[model samples]
Target: MAIKAKNLSFSYRKKKVLENLNFEIKDGEFIAILGPNGAGKTTLLKCILGLLKVEGEILVFGKDPSTCKKILEMISYVPQKSTLSTDLPITVIDVLRMNSKELNEEIIEDFELCDKMKTLFRELSGGFQQRVLIARALMKNPKMILLDEPFNGVDVLSQEKITKILEKVNATVLAVVHNINPIIHAVDRVMLLNRELIAFGKPNDVFTKENLFKAYKAEIPVVICEEGIIHPLYGDQHG
Candidate 1:
């Protein structure tokens, strides 16, 4: 399940979102799409899903996703948990059922939806909704799971649980994440994007002081801690 992009460029009514992007994810790799807001991270995912028209080549398993329905099934995308995109009156459990009929009440309950299943999706908190979405995504038994901000608005314990489950799952993960500290160890590589490829490699190797400074456009000091791991100092922002 190799995912590769070559000279990819995209736009919205002439406003460019991504440009000349190039990268590849080998089979069974956990690659994180790291970037700030409006960085074309989500648009890149949509292009792969064929929801957006774009320029250049995007190959999933060596096939163009734009014209192929089979590639769509090979990848399952989970939107931001709190996005109020769907219509109302739908229960959290109902959304799961929409994805898979094999997902019965019993299956939903096992995923810890017994109590929250009856609640309206719009009314339920963000964390609960994310859990339901994650549960629904698992039903596909997909080879690659593309998650957009999976940790956003999720509580710490729940985030830990979800990350652990994803780590243990059979699926390879390609996620757009904001807070990289928690799951940095879990991810095999990182792709820093801002309309282009800034850096892509193992977390420690790619999140260098120079690269982070360049991508973030802020002066962040680096400190060498125990085990020789480098940590960025937030300076006035944190202290």
Candidate 2:
């Protein structure tokens, strides 16, 4: 297994976020975390990454991130675009170079930033920046990746391209994205979180109207069509 969480729980100061969460992730698997805002999705990721103090047994390939020093270098993170500082006087390559340490031809092409290597990060669009962060994450040659809202402001075309690249990688992925339309077909399982693990299974099994209602406290309008069941989270829950 690439990752495992047992009885995982966390709190922000005194406000409880996650409560007794348990799950397992296999190697080379793509897992998408689904939840409403402030549902402890990002907090759970942070706990696994050892970014925050968490109370539970979190084993990243059987290693604790807090005690194991090299554990951190084995993973890469592509933070939300909104979390990035656009005003920073940094270049496209600068962010990649930070982790890469060494420049290579493949890096230039994979990120498609050879031309904009010198361009200011603030000047380029959001999609390009997402690619840059992904490239930077790969620099460490990690076995896993943690992405938070990776496509927040990316264009449709760019979103499509990045999805392909992520799948091509051999690393296991734990991503938190808003619109899963781009990766719905690519993911192996969906982990629904809301202070606790609501469900963890294949999208077809766990992404049901009942479970959606349990997790979001809202009914996701689903359409029965020739393609398949299309469920959308739009309407309020029936009280």
Candidate 3:
């Protein structure tokens, strides 16, 4: 298994976040986590990455993420694009060179970032910057990749390109996305979370009207496409 969370629960001070969550991710599976803001989606990812102290057990590749240093080496992470400073003076190449001794030319070409290699990180568009971050994560040659809202802010064309790049990645991937429309065809499974596991299965099975209503606490419309079923207007659930 790529990851296994058993009876997981977490709280910040007195506020409860996750509760009795349990799930398993298989090897090389691309899973998309969908939830409204403050549903503990990012917290779940952090727990898997061993960034936070949690109440239950989480195993990455059959090893504890928090205690095993080797597990950290097998993972790559791309955080939300908004978390990055666009005004930084560093170049794309500089970002890639930060942790890696040698650059992976293939990744640069694959992400279509060859031309922007010398451009300042802040000068590129949001989509290009995201690609740069993904490229940097690839430098580690990790077995698993975690992306937090990769398509949150970008043009339609950039979204398509980013989806394609993720589709071809040869690793276990768990990404947090606000909506499942763009990546409907790319991900193999869907995990709907709202401080708990609402549903988890293939996109066709889990993206149902009933499941979405439970997670979002509202009547969410589901569109049946040739690829699969998707929630067109998914976003922060506010009520």
Candidate 4:
């Protein structure tokens, strides 16, 4: 297993953010966490990254993240794009070099960032900045990756590119996404949360209207296309 959480709960300023969360992610599986704002989507990622203290247990590869700090090196985390500053006068290559002295040419090429190496990080579009951050996160060659709101501010083309790249990664992935349209078909499972685990299973099975209403506390449109893909029309931060 890549991650296991049992009765996991977290509180901020004495109010619970996450409560009694229990789930397991298999090796190499891609999981998408969906919920409204203040639903503890990002907090869960922090807990997995061992950035926050919480009740119960969260284990990475069967090791406690809080105790065994070494396991943290095996996991890479990328926060929401809005929280990252792009006004710095650093080049794409310079930003990447911060993580490792030896660069992976294949990754640079695969992300289609070869031509932008010399470009200033601040000059790139929001899509490109997100791509650069994700590429930088992979420099450590981690076994697992955590991404929070990766698609925020990203254009459709960049979203497609990022989704395609994620489909090919060998490591386990857990992404907190505001909209599931970009990767609804690629992810192995979908987790719905609203201070609790509302549903955890395959997208088709877990994305029922009833579950969506329960998690969002409102009726949400759930659509199934001709290809049998489930699409939740109400996947924004409005709540």
Candidate 5:
């Protein structure tokens, strides 16, 4: 297993954020975490990243992430694009170079950032900026990658490209996303949350109307595409 959580729970200022988030993530599995804002989606990611001390246990590849420093080296984390500063005068190459002495030309080309190598990071469009962050996340070639709101400010084209890149990685991926359409086809499973684990299974199994309603506390519509993919029709859920 890439990750295993047992009786996982967390609180902030004495208020519960996540509760009993027991789940197992297989190696190389691509998992998408869906939930409304403040539902502890990002909080869960932090727990897995060992940035928070919760009430239960979380293990990454059989090692306790909270206690094992080496386990952290096997993981890479990408924060939401909105949380990152876009006013920096850094260049794309320089930003990527910060993580590794030798750059991965393949990633720059795959993310279509070759031409923007010399451009000031702050001057790029929202889509390109997100791509840069994701590309930088790959610099370490980690065994597992955690992403928070990767598609938040990305355009359709960039979203598609990002999804493709993520699908090709030979590693475990866990992403927190408010909007799931961008990754619906690529993800192997879905973990719906509402301050708890609403459901965890394949898209077709977990994205039922009832599950969506439970997670969002709203009647979000769900449709099955011709390819038999479960697609949820909703914008960002703020509540």
Candidate 6:
């Protein structure tokens, strides 16, 4: 198992954020976490990454993620684009070199960041910046990867590109995504969370109208298309 959580729970001061979250992720599985804005989706990722103190147990690769140094090294993380400093005077190559010594030129070219190697990170577009972040994470050659909103704030073209890149990554990936439309086919399973585990299964099983309504606390419209069932993008408007 890449990750296992039992009776997991978290709180901020007095209010609880996550409660009794139980799940397991197998090796090389691409799971997409779907939830509303305050659904503790990011909080759950932090717990798995060992960045937060929780009430229950979480095992990443059969060890406690919070205390195991080896587990930390085996994981790579790409935070949400909002967390990054847009004014920082860093280059694409500089970011990659910060975490890895051996430069994987292939990743740079694959992400279409080869031309921006010398450009300041702040000057690049949001889509390019996200690609650079993904490249930096890949440079670590980790066994598991955690991405928070990998496609947020990017154009449709960039979303398609990132989705394709994710499909080729040979690792267990747990990504927090705003919409499933872009990565519906790339992910192996879908996990709907709202301070609790709402539903977890294949995309066809979990992305139903009932499950989405329960997670979002509102009626979510779902449409069946030639590709598959498509759910409306859950955002602040729904909340």
Give Cα distance to truth, residue 141, candidate 1, Å.
0.9
Q: List clash counts for every candidate, in order.
A: 0, 0, 0, 0, 0, 0
For model 3, the local distance difference test gives 0.85
Q: What's the TM-score of each model vs. the native?
A: 0.88, 0.92, 0.94, 0.97, 0.97, 0.96
Candidate 3 per-residue lDDT over residues 1-239, each given as its tens digit:
89999999889997889999999999999999988888899999899998888888989999888888778888998888777776879988999886587998998888888898888999888878888888898888889999998886677888898888788888999989886777888889999999999999988788777888888888876666665555546453331
- Candidate 6: where are CA atoms >4 Å away? 233-239
| lDDT (tens digit, per residue) of candidate 5 on 149-219 | 99877899999999999999989999998888899999999999999999999999998889888888788
Tens digit per residue, CA lDDT, model 4, 1-239: 99999999999999999999999999999999999898999999989988899899999899988888998889888888677666778999998887777898988998899999999999999899999988988888889989999998899999999889888988999999989989998899999999999999999888898998888888888788889988988677543
TM-score of 1: 0.88
Which clashing pairs does model 5 show?
none
Of models 4 and 6, which has the larger lDDT? Answer: 4
Of 1 and 6, which scores higher on lDDT? 6
Candidate 4 lDDT at 238 equals 44
lDDT of each: 0.77, 0.81, 0.85, 0.89, 0.89, 0.87
Candidate 1 lDDT, 42-118, residue by residue in tens: 99889878777779988888888888878877788898755657557898767887667676554465457888867
* lDDT tens digits, residue span 1-239, model 2: 88888998898888889999988999999998878888887887888788777888888888888677687888888877777778999998788887778876675697688899899989988898888888888877789999998877888888888888888888999888655667877888888888999999887777788888897787676654465734444422221
Give stretches of model 1 more than 4 Å off: 85-87, 104-111, 221-239
Error of 5 at 43 (Å): 0.8
State the displacement of the C-alpha of residue 122, model 3, in Å, after optimal TM-score superposition. 0.4
Q: Summarize candidate 6's per-residue lDDT along 47-118 as a digit string, tens digits.
A: 988989989999999999888867878889999988888788887788888779898989988998878889
TM-score of 3: 0.94
